[model samples]
Each structure stands twice: as structure tokens, then as C-alpha cells.
Target chain A: DAGVTQSPTHLIKTRGQQVTLRCSPKSGHDTVSWYQQALGQGPQFIFQYYEEEERQRGNFPDRFSGHQFPNYSSELNVNALLLGDSALYLCASRLVGASTYNEQFFGPGTRLTVL
Target chain B: SQQGEEDPQALSIQEGENATMNCSYKTSINNLQWYRQNSGRGLVHLILIRSNEREKHSGRLRVTLDTSKKSSSLLITASRAADTASYFCATGGTGKLIFGQGTTLQVKP
Candidate 1:
């Protein structure tokens, strides 16, 4: 089966502009989590979507929001973007209702560069 | 917020040498997982250790967890050049995962 897939492998936007990144979870997986990885830094959890609902979220600002579709796909929306928001957006997929202990498969990630 | 901190942000060793990286988290967790990422690539799951488990092994990898201290370690035995990459430890509690800064390993030939 194919692994997790993220669209628009790379993106560029103005500081105040908004951007939308998409992710398709791995086959048979139903939970999708979004993370932001700054250069030379580990990924910071943004939010998690399960069963088309947000089940958990990190400490990110309200400007960052997400949506999960009935197909188990997900989208991350960032508004009023700041240069600090420029980072690699990673999408990880986990099994439906899988325990947190289970392993998560990650996508190649979408690189967002804000000017 | 970050849940764990990994020591010695970077490490360099020759092939056949063993590489060990440590990670320490802040709160109680249900389990901890280790992931490997090559430059410009996605993270690859290495291993997962439950809070109740002390240690686990897979191929050249060995993981040890100390829930009491909220710490864990990943050991890559007989390292190969292919093992050069960044390693991250993610601590999970409930349904959320908090990651460490990550340790970069350079296994030179």
C-alpha cells in the first residue's frame, strides 16, 4: 500500500497571506496529525484528526486550524502567516483509534516559505 | 510545547561503532517512540516502548525506557554509514505526542 501523501511539496506566501496544505493518510489509517518542523528542530505537534474530528491539539495559536474529511484526508490552514511560520509541515498517519503507543507513519512533508 | 530534550544535539562515529542517544521528557506518558529521518526525507519509525516496558530490540536498534525518570535511550549497534540521520524521540500521553529536539548522527566510513 502507498504511504502518507502530502500535496504542494513546497509553498511560498507573503506574511499576511493564507495557505492550505493537504494530506492523505496511509492506507487503512484513519488518524492524521499535523506537525511543524523548524530548521534544525524537531517537529512540534499542531493538531490531530480522528474520525473526521479533531481529537487533540498542541499549543499552536488560533491562527492555525485544520479540517478532516470523511475520506480521512486532512488540510492545514494558516492565516496571517509570519516568517516564523516558515517551516516543514509534516503529516503523520496512524491506525484508526490506534493506541498512542502505536507507530505513526509520516509523509515527506510540505515545505512552506513565508516572505 | 516540547515534551523531551535530547542530549548532544549531534554525534559522529565511524562505521561499526555503536551510537547511543538519550531523551528525557517532562510528564507522564503512555509510551515513547523513536523515529529516524534522513535529510530531506520523512521520518521512519524505529521502535516503540510502552510505559510498562523497560526495553525493546529490533535488528540493530535497542530502546530503553525509564518512566520513573521520564527518560529513554536509543542505541544503534554496529552503525553503518546508512545510519547517518537525525533521530527523534516522541513521548505520548493520552492521544498527543510531544517531540524532542532530536539528535543528529553521522556515521562516517
Candidate 2:
């Protein structure tokens, strides 16, 4: 089975510009979450999508938004990107169930560089 | 703010030696997970310890959770150069997982 997959291994954008990253979750998984990993830091949760709706969100601002398609794929859009927004955008997928310990599978991530 | 913090930001050891990393979190969690990330790669889940559990082992990896102390440690025995990577600790609660800054481990051959 295929694991989580992300598109455009890398991207370059300038400040005030917008960019969109895509992700396809692992087979049999329905939940998708986005994260941002800055240099020398751990990933910070962006938001989570379940059943085509946002189920949970982190402390990110309104400029960061996401959508989940019916097929469980997801897109993370960052508007008015700043130089600080340059980081590795990661996508993780999990199957939510009664158990709260479901493992998350992450994609290779899209490296975003804001100039 | 991030919920978890890992100590010894970076560690370097010989290939045959053992490596240990510690993590401390600020809030209660249903479970804590460890993940490994190679350079320019995504995270790979390593192990998970529940709130009620104290210790768990998988292969060369041993994880211990001290809920009273709100801390967890990961031990990798007889490490190899391939083990070089950044290790992160994540706390899972309220349907969200918060990750630590991560510990960079370099196993020299």
C-alpha cells in the first residue's frame, strides 16, 4: 500500500505571495493534518481535516487555511507568505477511531522557501 | 507554544555505543509518541507510550514514561551510523499531537 504522498517536492515564493501544497493520504486513511517545520525546530501543527471538514486547528493565523477533498486528499494554502514562512510543510494522515493512539504517517513534505 | 521539550538538543556517540534522549511535556496527554526524521525527510513513527504505561520496548529501542514527572525517555542500544537523525517527542491529547523541538543524534562509525 502507498504511504502518504505530497506534491511539488519544493517551492519558492516571495513575501506577500500565496502558495498551495497538496497531499494524498495513505490508503484506508480518512484524516489529514498539516504541519510546519522550521529550521532547527520540530513541526508545529497547522490544522486537521476529517470528513471534508476541519476538525481541529492549531494556533496558526487566518492566513493559513486548508481543505480536504472527498477522496481524503488535502491542500494547505498560505496567503501573504512572509520570509519566516519558509519551512518544510509536512502532511500526516491517520485513521481516527475510538482509540486515541492512532499512528500518523507523514509524507516527504514540501519545502517552501519564501524570499 | 509547543507542549513538549526534548533535552540535550544534540548528541554524538560512537556506533556501538548507546544513545538516550529525554522529553518533557507541559500538559496531560493520552499518549506520547517518538518519531525519527532523517535529513530532508519526513518523520517516521518509532514508538508510543500511553499515559497509564510506564515502560515499553521495541527491538533495540526502549521507551519509558514517567507520568508523575511528565517526562519520557528513549534509549537506542548499539546504535549504527544509519541511526543518525533528529528525534522528536509528541504528546497526543484532544485529537491533536504537539511535538518537541527534537534531539539531533549522530552515530559515528
Candidate 3:
């Protein structure tokens, strides 16, 4: 089965520009979560989407938002990005059914370079 | 706030040896998971131990969780050069998973 798939493997954007990343959850998964990994640091939780609604978010600012569609795909949007926004964006999916557990599967991630 | 913090910012070991990394958390959790990442890439899930459980083993990996102490340890036996990567501990706080700084492991063949 396909784990999790993310779009735009790499991107280049100027300051103050906006970027959108896409993710498709694994088969049978319903919950999608986003994370940002800075250089030499562990991944930080950005937000989580389930049932087409954002259920949890980290301490990040308002610039970061996400959406989950009915098909279990997710979109992560970053607005007015700054140079500090250069990092790797990762998407993770977890099953939410009777066979679901707390285990999470991650995608290859989108590398964003904000200059 | 983050819940988990791993010890020994970095570790270096020889092949065929065992490597142990420890992590400490600040709150109660449903489960604690261990993941490995190579060069800031995607994380590969290694193992997960529930709060009610004390220890678990999977292949060459072993995980131990102590709810009272709020800490966990990941032990990798017979390490190989390919095992060189950063290890992170994630604690499930309700619906969110909080991560730690992680430990960088370098195994030499």
C-alpha cells in the first residue's frame, strides 16, 4: 500500500509569497497531520485535520493553516512566508477506524526554500 | 509546550555494539513512540509503547516506558552503519503528538 504521498517535493519562493503543499493519506486513513522540521531539529506539529475540520494545532502563528478533504487528502497553506519559513513540511496519516491504532505513517515531505 | 526531551544530543558507536538513547517527558500520555530520521527527511516509525505497558520489542529495537518516571529509552542492538540517523521520541498527549529534540547516532562499520 502507498504510505503517505506529498506534492511539490521541492519549491522555491520569494519572501512574502504564499505556498501550498498537498498530501494524500494512506488507504483507509482519515486523519492527516502536518509537521515542520527545521534544520537539525525534530519535526514540530503544525496542525491536524479530521472530518474536514482542524482539530488541533501547535503554537505556530496564524500564517499556517490546513484543510482535509472528504477523500482524506490534505492541503497545508503558508501565507506571507518569511525567510525563517525555510524548512521541510511533512505530512502524516493515521487510521481512524476499528483497525486503527495510534501509529502514524509519514510522507516523503515537501522541502520549502523561502528566500 | 513540548512534552519529550531526549538526552545526549549525539552518540557515536562502533558496529555490532548496542546503543541506548533516553527520553524524558513532562506529562501523562497514552503512548510514547520512537522514530528515526535521516538528514531531516521523513521519519520512520520504529516502535511504540503504551503508557500502561512497561516495555516492548520489535526486531532489533527495544523500547521501555515508565509512566511514573515519565521517561522512555530506545535500545538498538547490533547496530550497523545504516543505522546512523537521528532518533526522536514522541509522546501522545491527547490527540497531539509532542516531540523532543532527538538524539543523533553515528554508527561506524
Candidate 4:
């Protein structure tokens, strides 16, 4: 089966510009989550989406938002981007019904460079 | 703030040697998971240990979790050059998973 897939493997934008990254979860999965990982650091949770609604969120600012489609695909949007936003955006997905301990499968991630 | 923090941050080991990485979390969790990333790419799920479970093993990978101490460790046996990667520990209680800073391991041949 095809695993999770993300669009725009690499991107470059200027400060104050908006960017949108897309993700398609693994087949048979429903829940999708987004994370940001700076160079040489662990991923920081941004937000999670289920049933087209955001279920849980991290400490990130309001400039970060996401959407989950019925097909289990997702999109992460960043507004008023800053240089600090230059990092890898990761998308993970799991089946809500799988179990509480179900593991999330991650995509290859999109590398965003804010100049 | 991040919930988990990994120790050592970096490790170098010879091939066939065992490598261990530790992670500590501040809050209670339902489960802990380990993941590996190579060259800043996508993360590959390694193993998962539930809060109640003390230890688990998959292939050459072994995971131990201590709920009382809120810490976990991942052990990779007989490591190889391909095993060189960054390992991260993530805690899950709610829908979202909290990750640690991770350990960068280099296995030399």
C-alpha cells in the first residue's frame, strides 16, 4: 500500500508571505496531524485534524492552521511567515479506530525556506 | 514547550555494538514511541511501548518504559552503518503526540 504522501518537497518564500503545504495520509487512515521541526531539533506539534475539525493543538501561534478533507488528505497553512518558520513541515496520520496506542505514519515532509 | 527530552544528544559507536538512547517526559502518557530519521527526511516508526508495559522487543530493537519515572529508553543491538540516524521519542496521551529533541547516532564501520 502507498504510504503517506506530501506535496512540494521543497519551497522558498519571503517573509510576510503565505504558504500552503498539502498531505495525503496513508490509505485506510483517518486522522491527520502536522508538526514543525527546526534544524537539528525534534518535531513540534502544530495541530491535529479529525472529522474535518481541529481536535488538538500545540503552543504554536494562530498563524498556523490546518484542514482535513473527507478523503483523509490535509493542508497546512502558514500566514505572515517569519524566518523562524524555515523548517521541515511533517504530516502524520493514523486511524482513529485503530487503537489508543496506534502509531502514526509520517510523510517525507516539506522543507520550507523563508528568506 | 516540548514534553520529552532525550539524553546524550549525540553518540558514536562501532558496528556490532549496542546503542542506547534515553528519553524523559514531564507528563503522564498512554504510550511512548520511537522513530528514526535519516538525513533530515521522513521519520520511520521504530517501536511503541504502552505505559503499563515495562519492556518490548522488535527485531534488534528493544524499548523500555517506566511510568513511575516518566522515562523510556531505546536499545538497538548489533548496530550497522545503515543504522546511523537521529532517534526520537514521542509521548502520547491525548490525540497529539509530543516529541523529544532526539539523539543523533553514528555507527561507524
Candidate 5:
């Protein structure tokens, strides 16, 4: 009955460095999606993973990548990060093909600070 | 690019008052969902209205969707200080969600 969970509540990195944030989806969920929310803005879709494959992606660049593990957990990796990359990284998960209207459960975001 | 935009970027009202937030989207969606975030944290799902549905209610929250206008509005009735949060509307289509810049609502006690 646990909800979505994320690790590294806070991270500090410099420009050009790489950082990885992890997320464990809620029980009985198989799809994971990542989002980035900058200050004073809504979350921008990053990518979505299902069945261990990326099913959809947003307008993000190649530097932003993600992986879905067999257990339905997910990891968002940002490479060569810039100061602008500093934001709250959010993870949401849902059971694909569920009868419901694709309602996603979100986890407490990981605060990333890129200096 | 964000698909939805919320109106009155910020709103302040006293407790026992009602708070309304509107969202307009640019594209068609299968469902529209409203989420509440407190202080940049995780978003809590408020309600989801399907494309076919016009209005839905959950507790003190009432959501109205006007598909023809591509807009949705969330009404929080008799608001309490605990209702203070940033409200975001997300459009769901193609399995991915496109979010709007949230409306910050402050319900004063």
C-alpha cells in the first residue's frame, strides 16, 4: 500500500556533471514517468517508461535520459547538467491499462541544485 | 512547451471563502486532472474529469470541464488555511501528461 517513493531527497552538482535520481513506483504499478519543475513553473514532462521500454518522451534534450527496471522502478539521469537544470525532479507512476483514467501517483520530488 | 495555462497566477482569499482556478489547454485530451502541490513538493491528485464528462465533484472540490472551449476550472469551496497550495491542471493524451503553470492559492486563516 505504499505510495511512490524517491531517493536522494536533495542533490548538489556542478555544471558538466552527471546525476541520477531513483524512484520506486507504488505497488501494483508498472509504468513510470519523470517530470522536471523549475521554480515558479509547472512540471514539464521528461519521459515515460513502461514494460522496461520508453513509451513516450517530451521536448527534453538528449542529455535527459531514463531507464525502467524490471521491478517497475525508474531512474532519471541528467548528463552534462547546467545551472538551469536546477529544479525539483518528480516521479509519477500508474498502472498502465488500468480501468481508471490513468490517474498517476506522485512521489516526493528530489531537489536538484546544479551550480 | 506546456500545453495548459492557468489564470490569475496567484490568488488570496480568507478562510470560509471559495477559491476558483481556471485552466486552458491548447490541444485535445482524453482526460484533465487537477493536482495540488504544497511548497514545491509532490503533487497530490485532486480530481480527474474525462473528456466526455462535464462536471465532477469530490468532497469540497468541484471541477468543470468545457471541452469546446478547451478549458477547465476547479472550485474549492469553504476553503481552509490547509487548502493553501499551488494548483496545477494536467492534460492527458497519448499516455503523457502536459502540465500548466500552476495557480498559487493562499487561503488565509
Candidate 6:
């Protein structure tokens, strides 16, 4: 089976512009989460989606939003991007019913460059 | 932030040697997980230890958790150059996973 997959391996955007990254979760997975990994740092959770609804969110601002489709795929949208928004956008997936101890599998990630 | 913080921000060792990384978090968690990321890539889950567990082993990896101290350690034995990467510790609670700053490990051949 294929693992989690992300689209537009790399993207370039400028300040004040908007961008949307897509993610296809692993087979048989229903939950999807997005993370931002800046240079030289670990990933920062953006938000998690389940059953087409947001289940949890991190400290990110309102500019960062996401959506989960009925098929369990997800999209992360960042509005009014800043230079600091340049980072690797990672997508992770897990089965909400698998177990209490969730083990997330990640995708290759989309590299976002804000100028 | 409930993110965990890893010690020795960076480490370099020769191949065949063992590598150890430590992580400490600030709050209680349902589980702690370790992940490895190659340069410019996404993270790959390494292991997960629940709050009640103290130690777990998988192949060359040995993970020990001390919930009382809010700390965990990951040990990789017989390391290889391919093992070079950034390792991160993440604490999971209430459906959210907070990550640590990460430790960069370089295993030279």
C-alpha cells in the first residue's frame, strides 16, 4: 500500500500571497494532521482533521487553516504568507480507531518558500 | 508550549559507535514518540512509549521513558552513516502531539 502523499513537492510564493498544499493520507487511515518544520527545527503542529472536521489545533494563527475531505485527504492553506512562512509542510496520517496510542505516518512534505 | 527539548543539540560520532539522544518535556503526556528526519525531508516515526511504559526496544533502537522525570532517551547501536539525521521527541496528549527542538546526529563512516 502507498504511504501518505503530498502534492507540489516544492512551491514558491511571495509576501501577501496565499498558497494551498494538498495531502493524501495513507491507505485505511482517516485522520490527517499538518505540521510546519522550519529550518534547523522540529515540526510545529498546525492542526488535525477528522471526519471532515477539525479535531485539534496548535498555537498557529488564524491565517493557517485546513480542511479534510470525505475521502480523508487534506489541504493546508496559509494566507498572507510572510518570509518566515518558508518551511517544509508535512502531512501525517493515522487511524482514529486504531488505538489510544496513535502512531502517525508522514508524507514526503511540500517545501514552501516565501519571498 | 508543551514541546519537549532535546539535549546536545548536535552530535557527531564514527560509524559502528553507538549514539544516544535525550529528551525532556514540560507536561504530562499520554505517549512520547521519537522520529527521524533526513536533511530536507519529512519525519519518520521511530518509536512510541506510553505513559505507563518505561522501556521499549526495537531492533537496534532502545527507548527508555521516565514519566516521573518527564524524560526519554533513544539509543541506536552499531550506528551507520545512514543513521545520520535529525531526531525529534514528541509528546502526545488529548489528540495533539508537541515536538521538541530535535537533535542532529551525524555518523561518519
Model 6, span A4-85: residue lDDT tens: 9999999999999999999999999999999998888888889999999999998899999999999999999999999999
Name model 4 segments beyond 4 Å from true: none
Per candidate, native contacts kept equal 0.64, 0.62, 0.56, 0.70, 0.74, 0.62
Where does candidate 6 stray beyond 4 Å? Answer: none
TM-score of 2: 0.97
User: Per-residue CA lDDT of candidate 3, range B1-109, in tens?
Assistant: 5566898889999999999999999987888899999877788989888888999999999999988989999999999999999999997753467789899999999
Question: What DockQ results do all the predictions give, each relative to the true complex?
Answer: 0.68, 0.71, 0.63, 0.76, 0.79, 0.68
Clashing pairs in 3: none
Tens-digit lDDT track of model 2 for A1-115: 9999999999999999999999999999999999999999999989999999999999999999999999999999999999999999999998888355768999999999999
Interface RMSD of 3: 1.7
| DockQ, cand. 2 | 0.71
lDDT of 1 at B71: 89
What lDDT score is found at residue B11 in candidate 1? 99
Docking quality of model 2: it rates as medium
Per-model chain A TM: 0.96, 0.97, 0.95, 0.98, 0.98, 0.98
Clashes of 2: 0
Candidate 5 CAPRI category = medium
Which has the better lDDT: candidate 1, or candidate 4?
4
Model 3 spans with C-alpha error above 4 angstroms: none
Q: Choose the strongest candidate by lDDT.
A: 5
Ranking by lDDT: 5, 2, 4, 6, 1, 3
Residue A109 alpha-carbon offset, candidate 6, angstroms? 0.6
State the TM-score for model 4. Answer: 0.97
Residue-level lDDT of model 4, residues B1-109, one tens digit each, is 6787899899999999999999999987888999999999899999988878999999999999989999999999999999999999998655577889999999999
What does the lDDT read for residue B31 in candidate 2? 88
Every candidate's CA RMSD: 1.4, 1.0, 1.4, 1.1, 0.9, 1.1
What local distance difference test score does each model get?
A: 0.91, 0.93, 0.89, 0.93, 0.94, 0.92
Error of 3 at B100 (Å): 0.7
Instruction: State residue B42's C-alpha deviation in candidate 5, in Å.
Output: 0.4
